[model samples]
Structures are given as structure tokens and as C-alpha cells.
Target: MWSRIRRAGRVTALVLPCSLLALAASQSAQAALGSAPLTPPSDASVSSRVVQPASGTTQSVMRSESSAASSTSSTSASYTVRETTFGNGTVVREYLTTSGAVFGISWHGPQMPDLNDLLGSYFPQYVAGVKAVRAARGNARGPVSVDDSGLVVRSGGHMGAFSGVAWLPSELPAGVSGSDIQ
Candidate 1:
């Protein structure tokens, strides 16, 4: 029995890393933060028609009582957002400057969007900051925040519902405030 357990452990150790690698590689093409927005991932049903200005709305079929029944977006003179709604009812809004750089990203839904994909080059910094905060706070639960030098992230919610926003302060366009990202 002990030998069987040992063999199972070895198999798990070998398979876990390969599974993680596959997951990392299989991520659908997603727009990275701080870069120009790319096309939304293929899994998402994009908005087909443009509604009137400042009220661009799209319908999405949602699960778990969290449908983005009608996704609405607004654009100001200084910046705009490209919003995408995933199959799980998660809505990601990539805020762009006038010059087209993605300065911020926000999400809200029954599931969390992939920050690793959205944060792009900033993912490492975000991870380090989250670790530090956890270490300092002793595994306390509730909202999690990472306020790095230029990156500001705030996320909080219970199971089945989550929301968060992250933004690069230096990249925000003129006349655009952080409040405008959401």
C-alpha cells in the first residue's frame, strides 16, 4: 500500500507541471494591459452593432445569475473602452488612451477574468505584490489590493461574484481619471 501511494505521488508530481504548462500555452489570444488592445478572445461573443454614443450596449447570455444582459460602454473625448463579455458572464473592459494604448482593465462577474493575460508584462509585479500583502496580513480574507509604484489594483468579492480594476497611473490619458476606467 505504501509503495502504491509513493507511485501515485510521483505520477502527480510529473503530471502537474505538464498540466500547468498546457494551461499556460492554451490561453486564447487576449489583449495585454499597457499595450494596444487586441481583438477579444475568440470565446467571447463580441458586440455586433454599435448603439448611440456613450451608450453602446450588447446582449450576452450569462450563467449563474450573472449575465451582462446589456453591456453598456461610454467614450469620452480623451479615452475609450473596448468591452468584452465572456461566456461565464464576466465582462472585461480595456480602457484605452487616445493614442490607443491600453492603460487600464476592469472586470466584474461570477468568475474572475485572467489577470495574468490582462496584466501582460505586469503580471510578475502583481504576483510579487500579492504575495507581500498576504505575508504581511497573515492570510486574511476579503478584498485584495496591490498598489505598486505605477500599477493600482483593487479586487474584492465573495464566491460566485467578483470584481476588480487595475490601471497604470502614468499611462492614463490627459483629462482621464482613474474613476473613468470602470
Candidate 2:
């Protein structure tokens, strides 16, 4: 009985440290999710600017303009797309409408870009909507969408290749539709 008690105590000691480590890691990740700085959206010209720092490249975010294609124009409006590549091979593209509002944003890669940064002030609403939908559907598969009169957000991705888009519906240019965002 004494040998069994010692064996159990050793197992408990190992498990306690592992559990504490996992808890700390999760807390840090949650904090990091909302720690990215916010960038003001632009309306007129097409210019590529670093809106979100690519993962693992936080120090040189403003200087990492080489990953993006320059802004382009069309008959109705202009857009700037900034592509930031992460260490894990994810590429995030933020699309701004001519009015300077972020009409659309997309991500494709091994990990999803932080929505708290991409969604800006609207992240809370998106989170609430998602919670409601999940509660209602109880395990809904496929894409998640939050549609409001002023804002719209859609996100869906699996494992290593996740992707999502969010847009300000009212800020979309005259000739631009949500489908035109991607």
C-alpha cells in the first residue's frame, strides 16, 4: 500500500505541472489575441499599408510592405490590398473600399489571423453573433455569418487552411458587391 501511494503521488506531481503549463499557455494566447494595434481604414486612394502584423514579425510590421501588391483602381472605386504572410505560411489580405472603410478582409493559411484586429471595433458584435448562432445551431457546420444592416461578417476554415471575410456593408462602393470582395 505504501508503494502504491508513492506511485500515485509521483503521478500527481507530474500531472499538476503539466496542467498548470497548459492553463498558462491558453491564457497567454487569449491575451495575445486582442493585443494587436488597430489601424485606421482609408477611403480614397489605393495604398498598401500594414494593417496587421504578420505572426512572428511584430517588430517590423510597418516596414514589411514588400508582401503586398500595390493598390489598383477601376471605374467606380479604388482599393488597397495589403498581404501579410505569417511564419506558418498564412496570408491575410485586407481590402478597403474607396470610402476608406474596410469593406472586406480575407485570410488563407495555416492559422487564422486575429479577428479582433481585423474586425476592429466590430469584434465584440461578431463574437456575440457567433455565440448566438452556435447556441442556436448546437453544432452547425460550414461557414459562419453575421449579417447586420450596417455590417456583415463571414468566416469559415478548417484546420491548416482556414479563411474568413468581414465587411462594412454600408461602406461598400456603389458598384461593389460582397462577392466582389474576395
Candidate 3:
């Protein structure tokens, strides 16, 4: 009777492992079917320049431009530094740029959870969509133009909001156009 009990225990342990493995496999399969793949990072560098407001100036931000275009003719590259209000009511100074062809996006905002977390989640998708647009359009001889048409949300809070920027030399694919959103 004791040997019979021992044999039963060994069999149960083996079965438990196999059951767990099957469960894990099913969960992974469900994830693959239920969601899209995560976006990858863009291949552009970001730089920051700071300016101080005059002692009694009510102006919130100062603007400066330095024309340094990337070597790629297919890419439109530009940088802007602005003071903007974030979703959590925190005001932040940020610098962002995009390499036209590659659609590289990077920003620095307040250290708060709302600002940082929103950018972290939304940026990847934004870059991915931009890259897709670029790839579909093919090559252009000049920088792509982006127009700030106001903010639209993609996920959480106002942080996911994005302005519609036009890409110039609209080399949109055979069936695509600049008005279409990816």
C-alpha cells in the first residue's frame, strides 16, 4: 500500500509539470492572436538647448533655430523646444525632433508619473506609424514637412494627444494619400 501511494505521488508530480507547460503555451498563443506586436525605437538622436526668460518677462518660452539637416535626403530633420502643459497639470520644457524618413521621436518632460508614463507608452506607436508612412511613400529629395494641427489622443490622458503634421513631397503609395492616417 505504501509503494502504491509513492508511485501515485511521482505520477502526479510529472503530470503537474506537463499541465503547467501546456497552460503557458496556450497563454502565449492567446497573446499572439489578441494583440499587435510592439513598435521598435527610431534611429535618430535628440539634443536640448535651454534659454532663460528676461527678469520681468511674462513669456513662457523662447524659441531658437539651428539648421543642421541629417545626411539622408529622404529624411526631414528638425528640432523644436517648447514649454507646454502636460496632462497632470505640470508644465514642462521639452525638445523633440523627427528624422523625416525614419520618424524618430524623443521628448523630455516633467519627472511626474503622468507625463513620463504617457510618453513612454505612446511614443513607440507614434514612431511606428510614422515609419510606416515613410516606407510607403518611398524616397523624397527634400525634408518632410510636419504641420501641427492640434492634439488627438491615442491612449491615456492628454499625453497621448498628437498634432497632425504634414509630410511634404508626399510620396504616398499607389493607393495611399497624405490625408490618410496609418
Candidate 4:
């Protein structure tokens, strides 16, 4: 009887840690829109990462201009984009303001990243927006668009290829616009 008890205790010891780790992993590990993170989490293997620092006080976010981004301007109202390409071929980009607040997120690839993880606190808003769309149109058959409560999410794609973007209008940094999220 003592041996059985000891065996059960050992099993519990092994299972408890594994279960805790799984729970932690299952939790939302992303810090997005309206918030900042110490180091954003990524479940999938990262193939590459690129950090685009803020340029000077430009009229707009000129992502196409590498030289502009390379320049330093303390007065720049521009932003930074930390792009991560995962092993699955999906690329997720987080747009952060000078204060480190994540104002926007965009993703594109053969498979869609988990939006719940990406949106974090804003997932409920996205769900409500989807419900509203369904109620108005009878069906949100294709493309997901949520334009309410200062949150604008535009996402749509077919099988094997998907892309989407979400941003907080109020959180957008100076001189940034919808076009900058991409």
C-alpha cells in the first residue's frame, strides 16, 4: 500500500508540472493594441526577425523608403515595425509607437495565425463586430471587417493564402494612417 501511494505521488509530481506548462502555453501570450509587452511571445519557430525603427517626423510612414527609416530623428512621429517570419511561412508584424504601445498588427501567409492570441484584449471586440456584421448581412461569408469603437480590423483571404490587419485609430501615432499598418 505504501508503494502504491509513493507511485501515485511520483505520477502527480510529473503530471503537475507538465499540466502547468501546458496551461501557461495555452494562455494568451501576446501583448497587442493599446498595450506593450516585455518580449512578445511566438509559439511557432521563428525563421527571421526584422526591426524597422522610427524615422524622423515624416508626413507619413514610408515603409518603402529604407534610407528614411535608417535616418535618426528625435522629433519623428513615425513608428517601428517588428516583423517576425515563422516557420509556417506566416509573417506577423507589430507596429509600435515611440512609447512601445502596440497600435497595429498585420499578418500574411499560407496559414492564419491565431487571432485570439494576436488580438489579446481586443478579441471580444472583434467577436462583437463579427456578430454585428452577421446580423446586418445575414452572413459574414468572406472577409472579416470590424469598424467600430475606434477599432478597425480588415481581414480576408482564401484557403492556402490569408492576410489581415487590425489597428486602433486612437492609438495610432502622429502622422500614421491606415496605410501604415501594412
Question: Highest TM-score among the candidates is held by which one?
Answer: 1
Q: Hey, what RMSD does candidate 4 come out at?
A: 9.9
Cα lDDT tens digits for candidate 4, 37-129: 313345443221223334433333333223333422324435666566655567787776655567888889887777877787888999999
Q: Best candidate per lDDT, number?
A: 1
- Give each model's whole-structure lDDT: 0.67, 0.53, 0.28, 0.66
Instruction: Give the candidates in order of TM-score, highest first.
Output: 1, 4, 2, 3
The TM-score between candidate 4 and the true structure equals: 0.65
Candidate 3 wrong stretches, greater than 4 Å:
1-92, 95-118, 139-182
Between candidates 2 and 3, name the one with more favorable lDDT: 2
* Positional deviation of residue 19's Cα in model 1 after best superposition, in angstroms: 13
Residue 138 local lDDT, model 2? 87
Residue 10's C-alpha lDDT in candidate 4?
Answer: 65
Rate residue 17 of model 4 by lDDT. Answer: 57
Please tell me which model should have the higher lDDT, number 2 or number 4: 4
lDDT, candidate 4, at 181: 85
Clashing pairs in 4: 56-76, 57-76
Q: Tell me the deviation in Å of residue 22 in model 4.
A: 9.7
